[model samples]
Target: MNTFKYRQKYKSNYFEGWYIRLIGKKNIAVIFGITTNKDNPHAFIQYTDSRISKYYSFSLNEVETTNNSVEIGENKLTKNILILNVLDIKLNIKFLNVKALKKNFINNSIMSFLYYLPLECYQEVIYLDGEYTHESDKGRIYIEKTYGKKFPKEWIWIQSNSLPLTLASAKMPLLFNKFGFYCLFEYEKKQYIFASYKLGKIKIMRSGNTVNINIKQGRYRLELHLKLNNTVRLLGPTNNGLMTITVNESLDSNLSVKFTKKNKLIHQSTHKDIGAEVEMKNHS
Candidate 1:
């Protein structure tokens, strides 16, 4: 087994990375190892539905110290954390239980994500590079993916975020709310496929750190290369509870979120308002 490493500094060799668990109910667990160009810090999280397969890692930036907000991001799946000292200068991604999950799954991409994420991602969602409150009711968007050592061959990828705005986002994209999540696994004929189902009913309550989510009916297909950018929001509560999203828009053809599992749309979402905005939480 190769020992994972990380560094935090703006030195000749800046560092940043992290591994996350993909199994849990409410709060996901996260254990992490961080090394900057100069310092190394370790951290963990408190998952509501904690899983045993914890795994995580990350390369720290030079902006972290020890005293700062313990959390980052908003909503349930969001990577918000309780920072000890670091402030706006340092962007720390303390996944609730990211530390343990990374140790459990031990995926290799973690290293790539840490160093490349700062550059590839947008800043905090509040600064809102593209946050908009529009009135174009786009329809529901569906997505499908195959999990395993390699991507699933039968499943392709597609989304329906281009139709309109003001329409609630699809559940597929909301998974970004947490550091860890779960995927369905099964085998067909000769190939093995792992499916990641969306939390049809997700609630990002304002009172607590945890949230609620449930499965929705119906299934769609997508390609292996599809990159999903479904909209996600803290939909108000319903009779059952807080409604993540309701597909009532499909009735009028204007109030639905776009999705795909079997087919692709003519055009894709040109904008992503309810997308992940974790990169902006840094202070450094």
Candidate 2:
């Protein structure tokens, strides 16, 4: 089985989830997931329309999965298409002109550590960029994919199809020590990775709701700036039960990202309506 596939060997205290984001024209953004949280497993659908947000949850048994597809009741999710039907919303979307992030030795090697670690959570970007069309809703936008073996207790995730960037940084428990700040940034078709196992350097500065990350690898440097806007509370998994975690996410936030190689600028861009999440204890 592929290392990135959903694992079926989880323990009673473990959880696994898939995060699928679909952005459409006419100011529509849908973020939903299928979660198996041992204690309270379920499938959830959330979306925003005209600045109004709504959420729906269904039983875990309502979800089924193949190797690369997921079926939650009447909703289906795959790498190629998404057919969702919940409440008053119905969508039949197809992903076209897909552009996935290339998996190489370096990026693939970064995840090798998980094979030896006894950690409770992990994550990866399954799909980076793709054009999508919603037939029923008459909407069109970009789509992306993210799945994980439970979310980290403290982490910050940011992504933007407009900027064509994906960044995730986290601090979690690893064995007897803390995982420290490990980050992965993909931009301009290149991956700038900084992890504890790789012995790279990462510095973070946070003030109020804004976060700035500076990372240095062998001969590459990445700088990311993110600011939070109004957020909503979403259901997340804990060790014993499901908890309502406040995800400070804004599809309207601003992001500035720059990548340099050998002290020379390689790429830089500023994006709006970026997707961001800051989930830390007592912070969001």
Candidate 3:
């Protein structure tokens, strides 16, 4: 799980970003990204809370990375701790009881064998508990990283460490046609994984302000419904630069998830603080 994903040297048409969400009394997300497009190479930090969203950019030379951490200017993010020092905000948070995905040689990560393939984009998710200065501001946290030449044409991410679930799917280009792939991970008593490589049937539907998604793999099934709320525009990475792609994200979205085995229900719950992101060209 401690794979080095950040770029140390400048490269053309490449970008890597990490989405670190601190889900507590005041939900905050600290996003770090670096785009190496010869013409416009730089690093950035995007800070978002319940009320405001801020972005800071710097030169590529200011970026530092290790196998499990990335630091841009005064902001730094790792597997266990995150430090922020931008503007008047100063925070030092530590992640406790961090639960990461098991890694193997053949199927490196949650993406299965595709983690080693030369895809346009790759994503990895991690769940853990976080603590800051106040106890009320210490709770569950969700972290995900993406690195590649570019993101998929369309994609949706739904995650909640409180619910301990994450579902990410995208329409990836293959030659001239496009194929869909997804990974549904839920941890109740144990981790349940339903992914494309596991012969799963995944469907995503958009209706008005809500999106419905269903996944079936073997005898286990997962159903998710998300309603967008407090949606805001955020910067995403492209081959050109970090600000070229627009991402619609809602940190406090309404989400309902149902997981079952065979014909028996395993878990069903509704959550108000779900991290949801939708990046699409148009509504279908």
Best by TM-score: 3
Regions more than 4 Å wrong, model 3:
4-10, 104-108, 128-136, 175-179, 240-242, 281-284
Give per-residue lDDT, candidate 2, residue 270.
82
Q: Please report the TM-score between candidate 1 and the true structure.
A: 0.21
- Work out the TM-score per prediction: 0.21, 0.82, 0.90
Poorest stretch of ten by lDDT in candidate 3 = 127-136
lDDT of 2 by residue, 1-284 (tens): 24334555454445455565565555555655655566566667767643666778888778777777777789877777878788788878887776554555545433545644656556555555567776555333444333445556777777777755666667766634343554555554565556656666766677777888787878978888887776655555555335355555566678888888898998888877677777653331
Candidate 2 clashing pairs?
none
TM-score of 3: 0.90
Quantify all predictions' global Cα lDDT against the true fold. 0.21, 0.63, 0.74
Candidate 2 TM-score versus the reference: 0.82
- The candidate, 2 or 3, that scores higher on lDDT is 3
Q: Order candidates by lDDT, high to low.
A: 3, 2, 1
- As a whole number from 0 to 100, the lDDT of residue 54 in candidate 1 is 22
